[model samples]
Target: MANHHIDIHHVAKLARLKLSDSEAATYTLQLDHILDYIAALDQHDLDAAMPTAHAEAVFDVWRHDEPRPSFTNEQSLANAPKKSQGQFQMPRVVEE
Candidate 1:
């Protein structure tokens, strides 16, 4: 287990969270415990093991690329911040 004190306030600020002093202390301990658990993996010898994303065999089960019904132009443009002539309007992206 790692013996390091975490700066909970810094973490909370970065995550845009407003944590009280008690909450910060609680989270600090919880985060430290999680990190200590992860550090325990260092004791394992993983040289012979193959890295995998999952423990079991996984195959791509993809749906066929076929035409399907989609939202209409009105439905698509309904949420546009700025629109004109049935299309999204934005500042010019290129200069002549």
Candidate 2:
């Protein structure tokens, strides 16, 4: 990879960050290191490799999404502090 200089101030501005000159310099070196690592990874011979979300295959561990028994309307509202028209009553929130 070419030695591309990253504009730390520009990056910080885009990310809505307030970085000082020293901080920007530190981040620039860190970003350069990260880019170097990526460059090294690009040298790997993996033309036959298929892209995947994970390094290894992953199977779903969840159970089947089948419907189960639920509470009746009266049973659901039975413990409510206030109820009207078979529903929980909440205080008015909006003003006229």
Q: Total clashing residue pairs per candidate?
A: 0, 0
lDDT (Cα, tens digit) per residue for candidate 1, span 1-96: 447667889878899999988999788988888887787878999989988987788799888899989999999999999999999999999997
Evaluate model 1: give its TM-score: 0.48
Tens-digit lDDT track for model 2 on 10-36? Answer: 888899999988999888988977887
* Residue ranges of candidate 1 with Cα displaced over 4 Å: 5-18, 69-96
Q: Considering every candidate listed, which one attains the maximal TM-score? A: 1
Rate residue 29 of model 2 by lDDT: 88
Under the 3 Å rule for N, CA and C atoms, how many clashes does model 2 have?
A: 0
**Model 2 segments more than 4 A misplaced:** 1-4, 55-96
Give the number of the best model, judged by lDDT: 1
Steric clash pairs (candidate 1): none
Candidate 2 whole-model C-alpha lDDT, 0 to 1: 0.85
C-alpha lDDT of candidate 1 relative to the true structure: 0.88
